[model samples]
Target: MLDFSFGAVAMGHLVACVFFLKFWSRTRDELFAVFAAAFALFALEQVLIAWAGLPKEEQTWFYLLRLLAFLLIIAAVLRKNRRWS
Candidate 1:
């Protein structure tokens, strides 16, 4: 059973993801694309957590999803900076 809080958070992430996607479409910025991907991953992670009825994210493999999202953001930043330099 998905909790209200989790559902709300997931929805928020999805909305942000869409906004980022729109920005990416307008500017064609890789950073915006990466951000959108991260947000979507976050939403997926939350839904998976709720559906699986997981107790703690840290204790489960689901944590990897969040880690991957953060890593993607970091990689995007690094790549962008490298391109600028």
Candidate 2:
């Protein structure tokens, strides 16, 4: 169901944020901050997506948020990889 996907993504993003924060604390690296920002956006995107009662026009912004958030996550990962190597 759509509800399930939204919930799952929200939860997953939360978990990822927590994990990244822990890693950040241990490593004291700035890369984690990038991930944190990305995950935070991801959480926002999911919240917007879940509000099914919203107008179609509003939902369009949510979709854009989701796309940008998704790209940020990927950019964070790539940046982290480069930092590590």
Candidate 3:
């Protein structure tokens, strides 16, 4: 059951990546590029999570990819909102 859930999540991430990449291509926006990269990383992380087969207690390392993806999103938002003098 867990495998099925992981597969579904990975597929969702892949779809999101594709959409983001398409938007980036159309808009030439750094924010969309960052989003696409983040979603791609999320898809990779999901695969790694399934591949590792580690117990919940030992899954900390796998979470780092998620952290990096979130950080990329945060950085992109901040960059977009920064005021230009």
Candidate 4:
């Protein structure tokens, strides 16, 4: 079940990356750029989490990356809405 959850999160991050890239290409909006960066960072977090069996010590770093990614997503959403409104 843990493996499945990790796989699902990884896939979600990858999909979000693809959509962010598409948005960037289509609109060239800075918000999309932010999203793309955030998603890429999120993807890194997913990768680290998925492969965390390397060393138990690295789990903390993965969690930190996830937190940073979350902050980026929040920042991007706020910026996007502020621009639109």
lDDT of each: 0.92, 0.79, 0.93, 0.78
Candidate 4 or 3, higher lDDT: 3
lDDT of 3 by residue, 9-69 (tens): 9999999999999999999999999999999999999988888889988888988999999
Question: Model 4: per-residue lDDT, tens digit, 1-85?
Answer: 8767877887887788889889889989877777777777777876777677656675786777768877887887888888889
For model 2, residues 18-82, the per-residue Cα lDDT tens digits are: 88889889988877876877787787788767866676677877777767877877887788788
Worst 10 residues of 4 by lDDT: 49-58
lDDT of 1 at 58: 49
Model 4 misplaced stretches (Cα beyond 4 Å): 54-58, 77-85
Q: TM-score, each model?
A: 0.91, 0.67, 0.93, 0.69
Candidate that scores best on TM-score: 3
Give candidate 4's root-mean-square deviation (CA, Å). 2.9
Please identify model 1 stretches exceeding 4 Å from their true place: 57-59
TM-score of 3: 0.93
Task: Give all candidate RMSDs, comma-separated.
Answer: 1.9, 3.2, 1.3, 2.9
